[model samples]
Target chain A: MNRNAPGYVLGFMALLCAVFGAGVATVHYATRDMLAANERLNHNRVVCSAFGLPVEGRAPADYARAMEQALVVATVPDGRGGARSVYRRADADPPVVGFTFWGMGFWDRIEGFAVMTADLETLVRLRFLDHKETPGLGARIEEAAFLDQFEGLRPDWTAAPDRRVMIGPAAPTQAGNRVDAVTGATQTSSALMRFLNEELERLRALDWTSLEFEPLPGSEP
Target chain B: MSVRARDIFKAGLIGDNPVYRQVLGICSALAVTNLLANTLFMCFGVVFTATLTNVTVSLLRRHIPKRVRMIAQVLIIASYVMMVDTLIRALNPDIHRFIGPYVGLIITNCIIMGRAEAFAAQNPPWPSLLDGLACGLGYSLVLIAIALVREPMGFGTLLGIPLPARELWWHSWTIMLMPPGAFFMLAILTWIARSRTGAKETSA
Candidate 1:
C-alpha cells in the first residue's frame, strides 16, 4: 500500500480519528452523569449565594434544598437570536431577579450574574463566573472592591448608554448609577459597563409580571 | 535503570528540558503557576497527555502518513486532554472550575507536540513514553518552583494556608500574583537552570 496515496492517507486519518474519538467519547459517557450533577450543584451554590442564602460548609444536598425552595427559571429572548436565562428568587424577603450576562472583556468574553430587586431597579449583587481578562488588571473585576459598588446601584435606564451606568471616575455627589472602575483597567471596566447597561435596558423593557416562571429541576414545587 | 533509560531521563530533565532548554509550553507555565494547586493539576494534565500521546504516536508512527502526522498527533493529544478535563471535572469540581480554562490548553502545549515530532516519531513505545514523562516532569519542575515562590509572596500563603506570623511579616507583593510576576520568576528559573546545566540554547 502506498502510504502517500490520497486514499490511503484519508483512510488512515479516518481510522485514527475513530479510534481516539471513541476513547474520548467513552470517558465522557462515563462521567456525563457526574458532570451534570456537579454543574447542577454549582448552579445551586451560585444561586444560593446570589440571593444571600447560606452556603458556608454546606453539603451539596443543602444547596440543592435551598435552590428548590427559592429559585425559579424563566427564558427570555436575548436580542441575539437566542434565549437567555432569567432566574427569579421566589423565597427572598423581597423577591430578587437574577440573570446571566456576558460580553467581550479586554482579552476575551466575561460572564457573570446580576441579582436585582424584584422590581429590577436596584442591584443587590454582581459576581463573575468566567473571564479571560488580563490578570491583576481587568481581572480585578472579580475582587470585592470592584463588585461591592454594584450593591444598591440603580442604573438610569432612561439615560443614554454612557450615562446609564457610569464605570469611570465619579464624585460622591454624581447622579445616576455609578461604580468606580478598576484602576488601570479602563478597557475591562468600560466593556463591563457597556454590556451591563444593555442587559439592564433589555430587562427593564420586559414585562416580568407577564413572563412565566417554573421551578428549577430537582427543586420542590 | 538501563543505560538507555538513564540517558533519556537525564536529557529530558536537564539537557533537553522542554521548558528551560526547549522553551516550549511557556504560555501555560506563565498562566497557571501563580497558584500551587492549579500548577499541580496543570502538571498532571500535561504529564498525562504527553506520556499517552507519545506512546500512541510511536505505536502508529509506521502507518501514519508523513503528510498528516501532525494532524494525527494533535487528534491523539486532544483526546487525552478531553479525558483529563472530564476526569478532573468529575473528581474535583471546584478545582475544575478554577482550572477548567487551562485544561483545554494542554492540547496546544508545545511540549507534547514537540516530543511527538522530535523523539516519539522514531522511538519505540516504552522509550518514547519515558521521554514524554521526563519532559513533562521537567516542565512541571519549573512551574512548581515558580508557583512555590509566587503563591507565598503574592498571597501571603502557601496552598491557601496563611504563612506563620503572616500578619506581622507578610505584606503581599501585588506584582507576584500577576503575569509580570510569572515573567520575572520564569526568567530567573530559566537563568538558574541554564547556568547550572552549562548548556547554551541556540535559536531555532
Candidate 2:
C-alpha cells in the first residue's frame, strides 16, 4: 500500500471520520437524557432563585420538586411570531412570572433571568445565569450590589415612559427606571440595561391575562 | 515498572514540566486561574482529555498513515473533549457554563497535540497514557499554584470563604483578579522554578 498516495490519504481520512463520528454519536446518545434532565433542573433552580425561593444547598431533585409544587409553566407569544415560555408562581396571591433573557455583553453572550410582578412591570428579582464578561470589571453585573437595584424597580410605562434604563455613574436617583452601572464596566452595564429593557417591553406586550398553564416540557405532569 | 516508564512520568511533572519549563498551555492557565474552583475543573478536563487521547492515539499509531496521522490525532482528541464537555455539563451545569468555551478550546491547547506528536506517536499505549497523565498533572500543578495566590488576593476569599478583609484590614488587590496578574504570576513562577533548577531560560 502506497501511504503517500491520494487514495490512501482519502481512505484513511474517511476511516478516521467514521470511527470518531461513531464514538461521538455514541457518547452523545448515552448522555442525552441526563443532559436534558440536568438542564431542566438548572432552569428550575434559576427560576426558583429569581422568585426568592429557597435553593441554597438543595439538591437538583429537590429544586425540581419545589418548582413543580410552586410554579406553572406558561407559553406566550414574544411579539416576534415566536413562543416565549415563562414560569409563574402557582401559590402567589398575585402571580409572579419568571423568564430568561440573553444579550451580547462586552465579551460574549450574557444570560439572565428576571422575575416580575403579575402586572408585568415591577421586577421581583434579577439574576445572571451565564456570562463571559471580564472578571472584576464587566463581570460585576453578577454582583448583588448591581442586581439588587433591579429588585422592586418598575419599568416606567406611562405616557412618554422611560424605555431606557439609564445606567448612571452614581447611585440611581431617578424615580423612573435607572440603575447604577458597575464602575469601569459601562459597556457591559449598558448592554445589560438595554437588553433588560427591551425584554421588559417585549414582556409588557405579552398577553399575561390570557396565559394558560401548561406542563413544562420534560416535567412529570 | 521499567525505569524508562518511571522517567517518562517524572519528566512531565517536574524534570521538564510543561508549564514551568516548556511554557505550553498558558492561555487557559491565565484565563481560569482567577477562581480556584474554575482552575480545578479546567485542570480535570485537560487531564481527562489528554490521557484518553494519548491512549487512543498510541493504540492506532501503527495503523495510522504517516501523512494523515496529525488529523487522526486531532479527531481522537476532539472526540474525547466533547465527551468531557458533555459530562461536565451534565454533572455541574454552572461550572460547565463557566468553562464550556475553554473546554472546547482544549482542542487548541498545544499540550495535548504536543504529547501526541512527541510521545504517543512513538511510544507504546501504556507509556503514552502515563506521559499524558503526567503532562496534565504538571499543567494542573502550575495552574493551581497560580490560583492559590490569585483567588485569595483578588477575592479576599479561598474557595469562596471570606477572609475577614475588614477586620484583618486586608485590602483585595484588584489587579490579582485580572489577566495581567496571571501574566505576572506565571512570569515569576517560571523564573523561580527555572532559577532553582539551574536551567537557563531559552528564548523563543
Candidate 3:
C-alpha cells in the first residue's frame, strides 16, 4: 500500500481525528464537575468582592456558602428587552443590588461585577472578574488602584445626555460621577466607562424597587 | 549521532535550549513572564501539551501520510492543548483567567511543532516524549528566569508575595511590567545564556 495514496491519507486522517476526539472528550467529561465548581467559585468570589465581602484564602465552597446565606438572586429586565440576573443582600435594610457587566477592552471583552447603593446612582464597589486586555497595560483595569476609583462615584445622568459614566485623567480632588482612567490604558478605561454608563442607563430603566427575589438553586432561602 | 535519553533531555534543557538556542517560543515567554505564578502555570500547560503531543506523534509517525503529517501533528498538539486548557481552568480559574487566550495560543507555540517535526517525527515514542519534555522545560526555565527579574522589579512581589521594601520605600519599576521590559529582559537573558554556553547566536 502506497503511503501517499489518497485512500491511505483519508484513512489516516480519519483515524487521527477519531483518536484525538476521544482523548479530548475523555478529558472534558472527567473534568466537567471540577470546571463547573471552579466557575461557580470564581463567580461567587467576584460577587463577594464587588460587595466588599472578604474572599482571600477562602475556599470556593465557602464563597458559594456566603453568597447563598447572604444574597438573594433576582432576574431583572436588562433594558435591552432581555432579563439578566442581579444579586441583593438578603438582610440589608434598604437592599443593595449587585450585577455583573461586560465591556469591550483593548484586546478583548472585560467582565466585572459592581455593587450599587439603594438609590441606584452610587457605586459601592466595582471589581473586574475576567478580561483579555494586554497584561500590565489595559489589564491594569483589574488593579485595585484603578478599580477603587469607582467606589462612591455617583453617576449623574444629567451630566451626560446618554447617561454614560465619564472617565478622565487622574483627579484625586475631583468630585462626582467621574472615574480616573488607568494612566497608560486610556482606551480600556474609556471602553469600560462607556459600557458602564450604557449598562447603567439600561439598569436605570429597570424597576428595581418592586423586584422579587428567588433563591438560586442549591442555595438556602 | 546516537541520541540517548539523557542527551535528549540535556539538549533541550541546555544544548538546544528553545528560548536561548533555537529561539522558538519567545512569544509566550515574553507575554506571560511578568507574573511568576502565571509563568509557572504556563510552563505546566506547555509541558503537558508538548510531551503528550510528541508521544502521540511519534507513535503515529509511520502511519501518517507524508503530505499530511503536519496536519496530523497539529491535530494531536491541539487536542493535548485543549486538554491542558480544561485542566488548568478546573484547577486554577484565577490563573486561567489571567492567562486567558495565551492558553489556547499554546496550540501555536513553535516549540511544540518544532520538536514534533525536528525530533519526534523520526524518533521512538519514549525518546520523543523526552525531547518534548526537555524542550518544554528549557522554554519554561527561561520564562521563569525572566519572571524572577520582572515580577519583583515590576510589581514588588515574588509569586504575589509583597516584598517588605515595597511598602516601606522601594518603588516598583513600571517599565518592567510592560512589553518593552519583556523584550529587554528576553534579550539580556538569551545573550547571557548563549554566551555562557559559547553557543553561536542566530539572528531572529
Candidate 4:
C-alpha cells in the first residue's frame, strides 16, 4: 500500500537493517571467546562427573571449582594398542588419562568421558555426559545406576573387546565383570557399551607410558 | 487522529487481536506459554518491542519511502528488539537462558511487523502506541490463560511455582510441551475468543 517517496530511502533502510544485524552478530563475536570458555568448563564438569569425580554441588557457580580439580587429555595411539599423551592436564604430571568423546545415536548425540587409572588398564570412573534419547526410555544412561556399572571396571572392554554389556540373561551377582544394563533401555545400553568398547580399544592401542595422571586433591590413595 | 485511541486499544484487545483474531503472533504464545514464568517473560518482551516499534514507525510512516518501507520497518523493529534483548539478558540471566534465543527472535515476531504495518501506518503516533500496548496486553492475557490451564495439568504445578503436597495423580498432557500441544491449545483458545466476541475468525 505504501507508494514510493524516494529511491534512496529504500537504500538507507537496507543499509540500516544490515547495520542492526551486524551489530548483533558483532556482539556475539565479542563474547565468543568468553562463551567458548564457558562451554569448555561445562564439558569439563560433565566429563569429571562421568569419571565420578565429585563436584561441590550442581549449581552453575560450582563448575569452575569442579574443573580446577580435573583436566582433559588426549591419547594418540601407536600400532601396539597403546595410546600416547597428545594432551594432558596443566596442573598434574605428564599423562592425564581422562578424555571425552561423542557420536551420533538413534535419537540424539551420545557422548561421555572416562577417567582411567595411570595404568590405562582400569576404568576408575566414567560419566555419561550428554544425550537426547527418549526421556524415560533411552535417557536412563545419564542416571547413576547405568553409569556406575563401569566404576572399577577393569579396562575389560580393552582386553576382551568383543563382549556385550547385557542386561538380560541374569543379574551381575553371578557374573565376573559384567555391567547390569538398565531395564527397558536395551538399545541405549548396547550403543553406549559399543561406544565405550570401541573408544577404549582405540585408547589401548596408543602408548600410555608417557602420560601422567593429575593428582586429584584429597582423593583417597 | 485518523484512528481513535479507544479504537486503537479495543481493536488490539478484542476486535483485531493479534493472538486470537489475526493469529499473527502466536509463535511465542505456543512456545512460551507452557510455563507461567516463561509466558510472562515472552509477553513482556513482545509488549516492549511492540509498543516502542509502533511509536517509532508511526512517527516515521509519513517520511518513509513507499518502496523502502519494509526496510525502514526492519530497522525500527530491530533497534527496539535489541534494546529489550540486552536488557532481559542483563536482568534475568537464568530465564534469559531457559528462554534462550527466543528473546532475540522477538525481532522477527510478526506481531510487531503486523501492527507496524496495519495499525501504526494508518494511526496517529499516540494512538499507535496505545494499540501496540493493548495488543501486547491481549497476547499476555491469552498466553497466561493457556499457561494457567496447561502448566497445572502438565507438571502438576503452576509456572514452576510448585504446589505443596502435590502428587502426580493426574495424567500429564505430555503433548503440552511439544509443538503440537501448543497448536492444539491455541486453536481452542482462538475458537473461544471468536465465538465470545461474535467476530468472524480467520486462521493464522
Compare the candidates by TM-score and give the number of the best one.
Answer: 1
| Residue-wise C-alpha lDDT for candidate 4, range B66-185, written one tens digit per residue | 766776887778777776666555555446545645776787888888889988988789888898899988888888888888887677788677666565456677888666877888
**C-alpha positional error of residue A184 in candidate 1 after TM-score superposition, expressed in Å:** 8.3
Give DockQ for candidates 1 onward, in order.
Answer: 0.64, 0.54, 0.71, 0.23
- What TM-score does the first chain of candidate 4 have? 0.61
Superior by DockQ: candidate 3 or candidate 4: 3
In the range A1-221, model 2's lDDT, one tens digit per residue, is: 77878887888889888988898889888989888887777676777789877654677777877677677888777665677778888778677889888889998989898888888767889988778887667887878898889887877776232344566653347665777889999899888877877787787777666879876555676
lDDT of 2 by residue, B27-134 (tens): 899989988988998999999999999998899888788977888888888888988888888777778767777888899899999999999999899999999999
Model 4 C-alpha lDDT per residue in residues A60-118, reported as the tens digit of each score: 55665565556544445533455443324444443345766556655667877777665
Model 4 chain A — which ten-residue stretch has the worst lDDT?
Answer: A86-95
- Candidate 3 clashing pairs, residues 3+ apart or interchain: none
For model 1, the DockQ equals 0.64
Clashes of 1: 0
For B1-204, candidate 3 gives per-residue lDDT tens digits of: 355888999999999999888878878888898899999999999998899889888988888899999998889888988888888888888888778678888999999999999988998999998999999999899999999999999999999999986788878798898878999999999888888988874799
Residue pairs in collision within model 2 = none
Which 10-residue span in candidate 2 chain B carries the lowest summed lDDT?
B162-171
Candidate 3 global TM-score: 0.84
TM-score of each: 0.86, 0.81, 0.84, 0.63
The CA lDDT of each predicted structure is 0.87, 0.83, 0.85, 0.69
